[model samples]
Target: MDPRLLELLVCPVTRHPLSYDKAAQELVSPKARLAYPIRDGLPIMLESEARPLDAED
Candidate 1:
């Protein structure tokens, strides 16, 4: 994903800033405890498409 795009992206749930996990290809919303998937370089920002964080996460 483009760095400029990432900087503009935010968590749909919490409306907070997200951190990019390059290795995981995910946009992590710490406040929302959700991980939005980035597939084919496109972010799936929908809350319905998000994966809940595990206890260890």
Candidate 2:
């Protein structure tokens, strides 16, 4: 993803800043404990589409 876009994107639920997880190909919202998927080079920011983070995460 573009750095400009990444800088502008935030967690939809918590409104917290997102950090890109290159290995997982996700935009992680640590505060929200959610990882939004990046599909086909586009971010799926919907909460319903996010994966919940476990304790290990």
Candidate 3:
């Protein structure tokens, strides 16, 4: 992911800032407890496509 783009992107559900997880290729929203996937270098920011976080996450 581009550093500039990551800085601009926010969680659609909580409108909170997202953190990049390079290994997982996800943009994680701690406030929303969701992980938005990055596919083919593009972020899929939709709420429906996000994965819910577990206690460990």
Residue lDDT tens for model 3, 1-57: 899998899999988899999999999999999999999999999999999999899
Report the CA-based lDDT of candidate 2 relative to the real structure. 0.96
lDDT tens string, model 1, 1-57? 888998899898888999998999999998999999999989999999999999888
- Give stretches of model 1 more than 4 Å off: none
Please give the TM-score that candidate 2 achieves against the real structure.
Answer: 0.96
* Model 2 steric clash pairs: none
Clashes of each: 0, 0, 0
Q: Please report, as a residue range, the 10-residue window in candidate 3 with the lowest summed lDDT.
A: 7-16
Ten contiguous residues minimizing lDDT sum, candidate 1 = 6-15
Candidate 3 at residue 48, lDDT?
Answer: 94
List all candidate RMSDs to the true structure.
0.7, 0.5, 0.5
Clashing pairs in 3: none
